[model samples]
Target: MKIIVTPSQPYSDQKPGTSGLRKKVKIFQQEHYLENFVQSLFDTLVVPNDAVLVVGGDGRYHNRQAIQTIISMAAANGFTRVLIGQGGILSTPAASHVIRKYKTFGGMVLSASHNQGGIHGDFGIKYNIGNGGPAPEKITDEVFAKSKVIAEYKISDLPLVDIDTIGETQFAGAVSDQTFTVQVIDAVQDYADLMQSLFDFKAIRQLLASGFEMKFDAMHAVTGPYAKEIFVNRLGASTDSLMNCEPSEDFGGGHPDPNLTYAEELVKIMFAGENALDFGAASDGDGDRNMILGQNFFVTPSDSLAVLAANATLVPAYKNGIAGVARSMPTSGAVDRVAAKLNIPSFETPTGWKFFGNLMDAGQVTLCGEESFGTSSSHVREKDGLWAVLFWLNVIAVKQMSVEAILKAHWLEYGRNVYSRHDYEAIPTEAANSVIAHIKSQFSSLPGQVFGSYTVKLCDDFSYHDPIDGSVSNNQGIRVLFTDGSRIVFRLSGTGTEGATLRIYLEAYEPDSAKHHLDAQVALAEMIRIALQISQLVEKTGRVAPTVIT
Candidate 1:
């Protein structure tokens, strides 16, 4: 009934990155490749024999097959129950809610997360803790270590499970009298319930009832069904408000990243001038990333975090006032000002969501976000796209104002931070590292030096000492702060699947409301030039311009 097979050699390259082990579908389809990694994850966890293993994915090309394999292996490895999303569809946030709701022994999520999805595109698998958040770096390290020395994997010879049907199916287990059970759940209910509890749905419905126009682009990815269920069915929005609300295995041959580059269709519709909708939003693959747009205007992720922080009391979940806030290092400091005004602690962690785990667990922060089109409160562990959309809608509903009007009022009250990030993707790893090293080496001599209009006020390699667990992470990034409150940071991205990605972040504060209307690129043009000269990015990577800008 159980098949225990030894892998001839360990997989040296199975190290999990910031998210998970992502690779081409071909890599996962190789004989015993998926099994080896799954076994390694199981071996790293202290799962009980009768524990339930929640399994699901974004419904990508390899998601169904991967789920079947995971179910079989779960049975062989001692799990007595598995609860999965129907049709192998589960957004990242929904999967997190499921795990926490069921109190399972963690869970596995199959997703590449905003990456392209096809035969040659990327696929991924990650383990989530019982708190509905990603496993901390400590657990991921153990899983990666096990992957290097894994010798064998266990799997059952059970037939492929039918994930489409929404009910329970039982099978014989290891013992003669034992039977394992699999439950297929409605993917949208639990998370929608969470949203309902957090916001004033009646207000949102009333706003929608008043003939407001909004468009939600799901990008042919996992959020389609969930968005349709919540926005159209639950709210009073018309059917036409949803775009590409269908889950496709290859995401219709498109990258599902909800950015200006990937969600061009939504961008076009939202910025269509006189014909533009009142509001526009898009969610990335697996539904953890989001892009919010007002009529003919884009809301940068940094501003979104700050705006949410400034007005968090408007939402029901945060009406009692938020405890604190945390953000990635490269994210703009707008929220920091909000925290200061509230007299609450604001933490600056490294570029990964896992870094916020300790802070959140210690109840030091109520909201957290990143510059990468991601935002979330303490509602769920991972950055949630739909939850963010609802928050915006709730704000608009209660304020009875346009998205742009809200932004203007907020900026007028609390100065604006013009922020942008440039990404050099798929460069040589050696070259990317060189750029970081070059910038870091300049830190010692950068202080008191002048670069064009900016005089260096401080220079250092950013290091974070966890207040909750007392762990230290060093060399997270290189930050150069000017005397005038402007900043430039350089770091190599950990979420890339290719050679390497170098990220340069630019931010400059503008206290005068009159100057708030200046273009972001125009305002930071000098800082951008100085950053290039300081890091020698163009010479090192031979990239005259960034592959993407956000």
Candidate 2:
């Protein structure tokens, strides 16, 4: 193949965040801005000229344009084959699946996850290593470093080929003498097949058909196809049961996040009637995070994982029960109790899915979750929002109970780990840093300090040393553990590209079944208030309330 060299443009701010380089679409449209980042990603990879690669996005705005750019650059960089999803759309989980299925060196995923889409909204580009997990810190650091000084990016002036139909096309140049193949494969079949291998589809179908009402909201993003395939076609749910079952470039002019604040439409519909929907769920833009609700009742993500672990036998994939359970440091300790009872190891890690990859690879952990509306098993490296929704359906199917009944029964069995997460989003970066620093300063002498009614028993920054890889992450979050098992954690999220997000997680475990009836947010309100005061967040940020309380 003839070689082509395109000079890299002068582009700064190509640094990758927790997941990728996410920015407003307009920012990415700047001259050579996207190309520079793509070149940097290629520069960081070590693959042969004949290596195959996967490319796709969440069907967000600019997805096709970004894919075209990546394809040209990948070709210029001597990649032999590129397997792109049909129409340049692939859910985040689907991209991981394709990478692993093809055994590609790595893949480039364009998505901002649960954020809004459109010309004015956010866009992102992330490179996942061959293991189908997000690139490790070392690789991402190298990519970022190269991006800062990238001179230009190479691309072939290939014809504007249509991606809707799968076929092959030639670029018709010295560099394009080779064929740039596009395979318009079934986007949902492989992923659905993977889900089938992990869970019993017949059980889920029975649950949906046996007088159980479920509402699955796709939020007009990438999960629509997956949900339609699994829920309506395979699982026998009614056609109208799935909401927003069409993928829109602009996500239908709404934020695609599944949290209560963003997915208010679903919440309202579910709680509108006395005979409300039994099981209600929603997934984020790229379908990696999930929000689970039962009629008018919202099952907090922390509790959701614990309930799933306690009733793992309902799902055939976990029939043997989870080998081990893990949660982010900020999540409630509900699953910890389950792990203790089952005599399985439970771990606490930092707030990222990458942290769980090592444990999963080692077969030391089968299930893990974060407080940020995410849960997954070793079935895949990334969280599967739709999979979690199906898991809940299977649970209800085997138990033959309403959502409320199942949750009530769980509370009676495991008690309640009342949990709440307060997110102060887009605060001034300096102010957020100051709040964390203030919290850290109080750590050494805070162990025995008394505030109002509770006395702290232990205080320190949360850290993790992955048992499998021995990688350490210190200062994951700031924690104040009370003698009574009440705890508060403060951390700045690394996901956002703009201003900082201060996440305050509060948990109060009630082991007594008698007190399990209390509301979770109400029980943790006082603790959150105290945490805000101690962290000096209110005074520093000039905001007395969190942007979103989950």
Candidate 3:
């Protein structure tokens, strides 16, 4: 095949956010748009000799075409081998595992990650380093800089390889002496094996056999096959326990976020009157986020991390002990309490997985999570939805208790951290900025003020100082702390493709065991009102109520 050099213009909007470069499918379909960004990323990397590349996606619209384009470009860019998942499908965590298990130089994960999928929906691509973690800020910044000035891109005039079969295909590269190979492998097997090695699968199987009913919803995206392989084929869960397990290009015309508002079908069944299953869980598009429930009881992401840390030794992987723990800045202090009780260090960082990557690589933390339903340990870089669910199952099997029982006991031991997040989505950019500005303007005078039953203790924009690399990330979010340990946070979410997303996080500590059963929204109603009033969010955005509350 011959190498083709095509001239292209730079697109200033190619800069990646906290995750990756996400945009509408139509934007990616523009002439040389996707090629420009991919080539820019390649140009910033120093390809090692005989280096391999892992490539796959969440099976969304344009995934197959994008994989083909990336493969052809990899050949032209001197990659000796490319290992893609069968049928161009790989959950985000599964992709991370494949990159590490194969010891590839790097990998390209194609996903919008919980975003809607369709011709008019979102598409995204991000490169992960060899350590199976998202690329750090230095690499992402360099790629963005390269994208701004890119003038041309290179591709090989090679036919698309068969990605549906589990086999290897070889073809001559642009250079006569170079040969490029493509291997299509079963995406679920390696990840399942990894899970088996880490957890006590036998105990989990026995628990299921002993009438511990459960339900798992894949949201019609990636992780359907992986969940089936682990929960059904390996753990003996019946087929009826699975929901929306078939992968769909458009996610069955539903938003693929695993939240109360988006995963309504699963939530309804899990919260059914007296007929609910023992345990219920759902994973989002690309399979990186999870929502866990148990017989009408919902576990907040903050409490989930704390509970996992408190009982981590019950699971085989963490039986010995844990090194340390970490959580995002906006996350409640529940995990910190667990870390304190365990005599382990706990870190608070900004809202990206890359920060946790640095700490994990340095061995400073064994488990880390964010408040947005994302959780994982050092087993792999990205958050694993199925892995978290399996961890909970393993813990349940060992403890021989229901999910609600475990949570109540946990709250009784360590004070409950009542928490909720309210999201105002699709707000105009100018209005969102105004809301943030309104909050920041009051930071000087807001301290020492009294609002209802709470008195302000501090106010500032959240910032993170990386312990491993000594890098500083400033202006992460706005925080208003009250004297009673109850606080509120305001942030502009970077994951959405439409207008800006304003997220308000509310948290209040309750040490009384009797009050642990109170609804989170009810417990923090005063703080939520104060948060909105402090930021003037409703007045500026004209949104009387948030788009979603969780």
Candidate 4:
């Protein structure tokens, strides 16, 4: 293939956020905009001339076009080989799995996880390190610096190659003489095989065939294929059990987030009228986040993790029992009680799945989760949404109980961790910062402050030091602990497409069975209201309500 070098204008809005540089699709359509960022990635890495690069996306809007551009750019930057997923589609976890499986130098994953799609919605470009985790601060900082001053980006003027077929295409670069090969491979089989190795499919199959009615909603995102393979093909689930089991470039014009609000359709069908779907679960875009529900009963992510840990032995994969459990600082402390009882190490880290990578690597943790509807084990660095869902299935199958029965049983055994998160999204950046600042300033005096019925006992900005790498991340979230074990946490979401998202996480641990009947959202509503009042969020943002309450 002939090589074409394009002189690209400098584009400056390339600084990566928590995950990657996500913006409107129009920004990526600018002349040499995507090219500049791709070049900056290569330039910052200064990788070997013949190093391998993995390129794929979540099959979101512009995924194919972006992959083509990246492949050409990789060739131009002297990469010897690029492992492109078949059809330019790979879930985020699947991309990480491929990166590690092939031992590639690193990877570029195109996804705006849990964000809306379409020409007017969000698009993202994230770089993962060779370890199959999100790029660390140092590398991302370098990429941002290089993107600001990039004057030219090299790309071969090669014809658009079909990425759906499994084959290799060789191309020559303009600036370099080295040839590059694009190798397309199936995206789902490897990930499915990995899942098989981790869990007992035969037992899960028995559960499915034993007349357990279940529902798995892919949300029309990237997990459709994986869920179909596992649920319908391997586990003997009926085709009707899965919803939206097809991948779409535009996510079928729906936001592929699996939260209650975005996934109301699935929620309605699962809880439809007198008769309800037995087991209900949904995975978000990129297939790394999941929301597990049971008919009209909702299992908070915090409670979900605790229940899973409490019953880890039921699944053959965790038959040996979990080594330890951990959660993000903002997550409820319900798991901490289980960890204490089990006499296992429990850690509280900052938000973000990358933080768990070190713990998993250190072998100090086996199961870890975040309150943001994410759960995973040491099986993979990134959270596996489907894996968590299947885990709940296995538990239900082994226990021979309905979803509601299992949750109620769990509550009877471990009491309840009433948890709720109020998300004030798209707040003005300044106002969000002010809210955090005010919260931080009051920490010293908050420990003794008395609200309506509760008195603050502790307050601090959460931080963590990874045991494996010894890397420290500070100021993860602002937390206030009340004397009665009711706690509230405040943090600005780093993954938002616009402005800032102030997330208020509330948790009240009820040790008595009598209090277990309290609804989570109602139990924490007043505490969250007090938190907002103290932070002056309403006064500053001019909005009295949160955009979404998870």
Considering every candidate listed, which one attains the maximal TM-score?
3
- Shift of residue 239 alpha carbon in model 3, Å: 0.3
lDDT of 1 by residue, 1-550 (tens): 5555655457888888788888889988888899999998988896687899889999889999999999999988889999999999999989888988888888899999998898888899999888888887788889889988887888888888899999999998778988899999997888888889999899999988898999999999999988988888889789999999899999989989998888999999998999999999999989999999999999999999998998899999999999899999999999999899999999999887778767877788999999999999887789899999999999999888898898889889889999999988999999988888888787788899988778999988899888888888888888899999899998887776889988899999999999888878899899899989999989988999988889
> What are the per-residue Cα lDDT tens digits for candidate 2 across 213-263?
889899999999898888888888898898997999899999898988999
Quantify how close model 1 is to the true structure by its C-alpha RMSD in Å.
1.3
Give the TM-scores of the predictions, in the order they appear: 0.98, 0.95, 0.99, 0.95
- Cand. 3 TM to true fold: 0.99
Question: Please, what is the whole-model Cα lDDT of each candidate in the order they appear?
Answer: 0.89, 0.83, 0.93, 0.85
Give the candidate order by descending lDDT. 3, 1, 4, 2
Q: Candidate 3: worst 10 consecutive residues by lDDT?
A: 171-180
- Candidate 1 global TM-score: 0.98
Global CA lDDT computed for model 4:
0.85
Instruction: Record all residue pairs in model 4 with backbone atoms less than 3 Å apart, i.e. clashing.
Output: 4-157
**Highest lDDT scorer:** 3
Which residue pairs collide in model 3, if any? none
Q: What is the C-alpha RMSD of each candidate to the true structure, in Å?
A: 1.3, 1.9, 0.8, 2.0
